[model samples]
Target: MGSILIKDTTREERERIVRESLGDGFDVTCGYDDAGIDYQQYIDGKKELRELNAEADCGFVVAHPEEQQKGCNNI
Candidate 1:
């Protein structure tokens, strides 16, 4: 399982995709089933990601700023 995308969908549609893509829904919503998790932060981060994607589709997103062969050169 490498990079993937399931673009443009509502929450219900995302749920269906989760059920199909992963038998579990851990990555579908803002929070996973963890005890004492700061759910507000999780939700806020998810919102931020959505806003960023909306702004520019995050085409400029990067994990590495240089080509030193560091981590996850995947994109």
Candidate 2:
């Protein structure tokens, strides 16, 4: 797995940057803004968005396994 940090930008801009950086080969997944007002209307909104985007755009889903497993022994 690989990761990239994007800062100092609007949500749309960040999305564009991530899309451009990812290029046209591998699938892309965005794991930012889960339940923020601009993202979605529910918790786990990030996952929901990822699924929607992956289905509609054929991009890979983005997720932080370490973060998700921080309090668990599933790693």
Candidate 3:
């Protein structure tokens, strides 16, 4: 099991990703940051977006932009 990191996107895009991020028997969790307010708790209809903040650009990130993949599978 692993995680997918999505950043620098809009709510519509995020929603789309979230929709596709899940499938039959597949489990995935996703969330983003709005300025300083984390969105994981608010995504998936858990919360609603009242105001759109222009400063938000996926601040709550999981993997870093320069994060390296440590795949355990050997060739």
Best by TM-score, which number?
A: 1
TM-scores for every predicted model: 0.29, 0.26, 0.25
Clashing pairs for predicted structure model 3, backbone only: none
Cα lDDT tens digits for candidate 1, 36-75: 2322332333433333323333235556668556554333
lDDT of 3 by residue, 1-75 (tens): 232223345555555555564443333343343244344533444443432233345455556756746762232
lDDT of 3 at 61: 59
lDDT of each: 0.40, 0.38, 0.42
Can you tell me which runs of candidate 1 are displaced by over 4 Å? Answer: 1-7, 24-68, 73-75
Best by lDDT: 3
Give Cα distance to truth, residue 31, candidate 1, Å. 7.0
How big is the RMSD of model 2?
A: 11.3
lDDT of 2 at 3: 27
Per residue, candidate 2 scores C-alpha lDDT tens digits across 1-75 of 222222334455545545564465523343333322222211222433333443343343448755664544221
